[model samples]
Target chain A: MINSEHTAIMLIAVPLLGAFTTAVFGRVSSSLRNIWVLAILASTELLAVLLGVNVLEKGINVYALGASFPTLTSPEGFPVRIILEVDAMNALISLIACTITLIVVVYCLGFMRESRVLDKAYTLILLLLTGMLGLTLTGDLFNLFVFFEVVSISSAALIAFYVHRGQSLEAAFKYMVISATGALILLFAVAIIYSQYNLLSMAALAASIKYTFLDEVALVLLISAFLLKAGSVPAHMWKPDAYGEAPAPVAVMLLTSALVSLYVLFRITYTVFNPVTPTIGWTLALLGVLSIFLGVSMALIQTKLNRLIAYSAIAEIGFILLGVGSSLTQSPHTSKVGFNALSGGLFHILNDVLDLGLLFLAAGAIYYLTRENNMNRLGGLGKTHPVLGVFFLIGLLAVSGLPPFNGFASKLMIYESVYFFNPLFAIIGILGSILMAAVYVKAFYSVFLGVFPPQELGQIPKSMLAAMGVLALLILVIGLYPATVIKYLITPAADALINPGDYIGGVL
Target chain B: MALKWRYQRMLANIAYITVVVLIGLGLYAIVFKQNLIKIVMGVHIMGSGVNLFLISLGYREGGVAPIYTLAPKLEMVLPTPQALTLTSIVINLAVVALMLSFVMFIYCRYNSIDSQDRRLRG
Candidate 1:
């Protein structure tokens, strides 16, 4: 039987091999290349489902990379050789990442029906997925960084793939400049940690972060860099232009990457800086509140759909940050409030990816139907394309934290948890939810609910619907049984977050 | 504190400030400039200045180059920052080169290099 950890890893390697071959063969024929991309992504989805089944069964399974055995005394046990560590924490998240990636890949094919140079696009997509997978599974810090670079570069290249628009060039240039700066800052922090303790594994590094001024400075610097990567307010100016100008699927991919990076940031704060007495927690919480207000206020005024989504994403990030911040700062004596907030934050990450993935796909679909993504020019597409309208509705409802959806459940947890922290922030958080809902309603009314567009654009292909439908289904399932998933996946991940000693014990 | 060390600390801190001022001026030029290439050069100058600042994080009272000799000692300069500087340099080079390539692509499309003015008017 395939265990939890390497099952996901095996899933990763197959696509990596496919990506390399596709890159080699991508020059051969565009039609043949499309098949290769679809087949690989389809196979990747299969592996993710199989791996999820195993993770559900085993609770939290940690498998060594390149070797079958697991021993505490072994160097691999310390995450020395880039171990693929998967637990219930990452199992659900992994499935969502793979599922979204596959959907995006398929949607791209239909979206690029006119293009002949589509094979390079397919190769880049698979490579990006591999890097995202490696980033999710890697138990080592430097290894994670390497994978992050791989994903960042591939996605950045994907942004400029069309090369037809000056806006894309401007977006890509600003993206590279800002991203490179962040990457350098991250490397500097990693070196500081590695130099202090001759180990670069996340688990090991956390174990080694004793209370020292050096550690404090390093932690602050890392937080700054990661917030930049996470696309928080003060550091998030590039996100709107970058995401807006990129192809819609690429925009969705970048959103997932942003969530993934934030997940890493949460893991870092909980594990590396856990020992400090709650000051870091308050500081982080403040950052979250600031981002929430800024993002929402900005989103309200955006005339373009992509810019709206980008800003709203920044607002949602505030919610995640709030949950994490409250959990960190909570009195060690109170378990329920802290645990709920932390788990809620992690849950929202999964919810955000799928729901947002569908929405971006919908945006792409809308653009494909009508040449413009501007809300001003678009209206009443609902009658012409019923399926796209429903997909957009489900996505909009879920992200707005409406009832009977995954976003609602996670935001409930965040609200309840925040009630215990501060009433003002809780109110602000709800206000943010309302603002997002309002803006998206404006988005929905303008695009899907109004007057019909010109007939020249034709329908968005059925392949695109397949992708959106799958993401919608994921949101429904997670929404329906929040407790079961919370008990199984979120609990274990949050457990590891709170008692990071467990992760340290597992590795070192 | 030793007398020789006091003089060195004063001199070194002064050097840091001077370079930092030049970096600020260069960045000011980059932000306010209308030319694309000059802005890129300004960014490079600012980047190098930051790289220098990062290296200075490892500075100490009486430290030498980080290479280890046969006889082990703890008095050597902090090798960590040096390693950080090396990685930072490679990453910076990659970033700058990619930026230039994008500029070239932009030049081809627009038939001009005055990015700010063109972006504004377009």
Candidate 2:
């Protein structure tokens, strides 16, 4: 068995190594490049699983870089250098990220067959994955900022991969600008924390946090920057652009990238700030509600399929925020209710990953077939591509939180708990779900059940089919066994977040 | 207060004000400027302002550079922020390069750096 300590770095290094190797060797043979990319991603996924297993077994694993040993602190007992802390929460996210990436890599073999910059695309994908893994796992503040940049830069580059497409460049430019500005603000926040605490390690800062004016400033800056990164409503302008223009596989990766921002938002609020104010929960819920209403309402009118899905994604993020936000309240009764909301939120993250991923892949299939992203131009795909129809239906059902799907299981929990916060919150959430359902149903009818076009359609590739099949299957299984997953994965992940002292204690 | 102490305090205060003013200028440019290049420059200025804030966080009056071998008895400025400033500078440099490359791509495609270009309404 590989030593557990090495697993964290291996998770990051494997992808970084693959990125460079594919860049150099990919030009030699396309088949060779595909195999190389597949091998590294497969291994990375394995390592992620191993790390997750280790986190469950070992509680929390801390790998201090450049230290003589796996010691937590310097001779003076302060955490002085960079560290990678893998808790159940980070482990779960890393696993989700790597799994989605592996699936997307498989799907891309077929999706990206015609693209000119295949090698560059593969390299950027791996780099983005590395950035995400590091962002999820790193314990150092500065390191997180660095990895955030890595993810942003690569994602922007990937979004603009279709250079001939004019809109792609514009989307990439907006995404790049927003991401750069957010990173700068985040750095300023980091500097503020450092100036006060004289430490860069998150655990160290958490142990030393004073909740002063500077701390509040840092908190606001951190929240806004990450909220922008995650594409919340007011800050969500660039998201639809990036997602609508990026290649299908890259679009799925972009969702995970947004997820990383959400993860950071949770990490900063719960761990670093440790619920400094009671209002945090309500504030998140307000944002969540706005995102849900705006995202779904806007999604209703979009002409293009990808943009519609992108809006739905924004709404999905809002659901997660609402569920998690319910728990941030200070009332004892609400805190008890918050645990349930937290579980729902955590469970929804997984559901969102698979459901949204399946939809994007299905959209890509349609795009692959008709070469038309405009929904008005798409018609009668159901008759020609029955399996994709089923896949699309499954994705639509899951996303709209229909019964017997993973989304419903999580959404149910959210509604049940959030009702305790206020009946109106749950009511609005239900109303949003209804609107979301209507939007997707319309999209499905227009795209698949409408008039059949005379143009010849492209056949779906076996690899792409397999990728979608697996996601659909997982969605079904999770929906069926929601209790088992909640008990094992969601509960522990929520506990990890709810109990910040454990995280700080483990490192300090 | 001692003359030396007063001067040092004034210097540090000026540094703090410079940090604030620089960041304000950067934000102004970003929010008010229409040109993409100016916005990119604003991002750079904001980054520099943050870097300056970090470096100033470690500054100590009458302190030597944080080299132990050169001055063992002198009060040394904290070196951590300097190190952090270096890292932030490199990251910012990477971001600036990326922003500029994006600007080039945008210019090549749209023939203008105006943020108002409505190629994508999203």
Candidate 3:
């Protein structure tokens, strides 16, 4: 029988090994390299799922490194080495990261077939997966910072893959600057926490935190750095630039990367600073409102297709943040309300990944066919590529939070729960969703419904269609079974977040 | 307090002030500088300042190195921060290399390192 502990280690190790082997052997035969990558990713995703199920079934899974026999606590009864602590919350997110990465890897086969730097792209993708897996799985604070750097550097390289395009390199530089700065600040926060408690383990820090001035400084630093990484309003300039300039497959990967940052943001706010500080929670809400307002409003004015979707993505993040922010009110009456808000927020993470992922794939298909990203130049794709049009329609409806779609289920929860907090905020949230719908509808009209362009569009690749088809199918299934998903996946993850005692106990 | 002891306290304060000043300079450069290389340098300076602060956290008066071979029984400085600073310094190296390569790419593409002339401007 395969131990679940081994699954945790394999989830990260396999990808790192595969990345290196692919880079070395990829030069000999591209097809062989592609198959190798697919197989590696397939196993990684399976193991991630297995790990998630294990965590869900048996509570938190702690795999201690360099121990006598891989136990949680040392002989002296204190955790001293690095550990992989997989609770329901991280396990679900780790599964989401792997699942989305697998889909994008499949898409990349067709998307980057003709590009000369295929080996580098594949290698970077695998390394990117390694970084993300490590980021979500590691129990040590310093290890998290290290893995965070891995994600940022690999992603920055992937964003600038098309070096010939002047703007892409420009985008890459901006992304690197922002990420590097955020990472250093994050490291400084880690240092601060380390200095205070003389420990690097997250659970230990959480247990020992005194909420001192230094702790507050660390908290502010962490919130600001993660908020910036997740591309909230004040620091969101990098998102549209990076997402719009990256290749479609890479853009999808970047979306997941940004989601990891969001995951960390919630993890820190909830676990490290649990019982949700009223001020911090409200501060997060304020940022969420701005992101929603700016993202949807700016998306309305964008003429470019990718940039528009990117802006809409920012707005979607706002919704998730809103749900998360609502959970910060800690009164006894509001605790029930906070749980509901957190569940909605958690569910929205999955919904956003699927919906935005589908839309990006549709956008990629359109770009793949026409080599055009400007809505001004794209016209009548509905006639030439009906499959893409259908896919785009599903994405459009789902993202705008219409009923019978997964987005609607979560957003409705968000809308109701947030309403308990403030009626005006709920009203504004509804307005943002409405504006988001208009933005996507406008994009649909401009690109897919207009008069047929005289220029001929290329046929979409089968592999790309297969990728989109799978995403579209998942969206439909989740949309159909929202309650089942909520009961099984969303609630456990929320429980894990609200109660970090299990996480700390499992580690120490 | 004795004058010499007061001087020693001021000296210790100077060390902290220097770290703070270096961090301030780094942030100033990162936020206000236009040159890409200068921005990269700002990141470097900030990183160094933080690393310095980390090393300072491990300092002990008249303590020997925390090496087992040299001082198995002696009072030694806190070694964890030194270890952390080592890891951080390596990470900083990787970041600096990546940032510099990106600057090279930027120069090749736009022939300018001025952030204003870049196409990604808001």
Candidate 1 stretches with Cα past 4 Å from truth are A1-12, A46-84, A331-334, A454-457, B1-3, B7-92, B111-115, B118-122
lDDT of each: 0.76, 0.89, 0.87
- TM-scores for candidates 1 onward, in order: 0.86, 0.97, 0.97
Model 3: CA > 4 A from native? A69-79, A331-334, B1-6, B70-72
Shift of residue A334 alpha carbon in model 1, Å: 6.1
* Ranked candidates (lDDT, high to low): 2, 3, 1
How would the docking of model 3 be graded? medium
Q: Itemize residue pairs with steric clashes in candidate 3.
A: none
DockQ of 1: 0.28
Best by lDDT: 2
> lDDT (0-100) at residue A426 of candidate 2?
89
Chain B only: TM-score of model 3: 0.90
True contacts kept of 2: 0.76
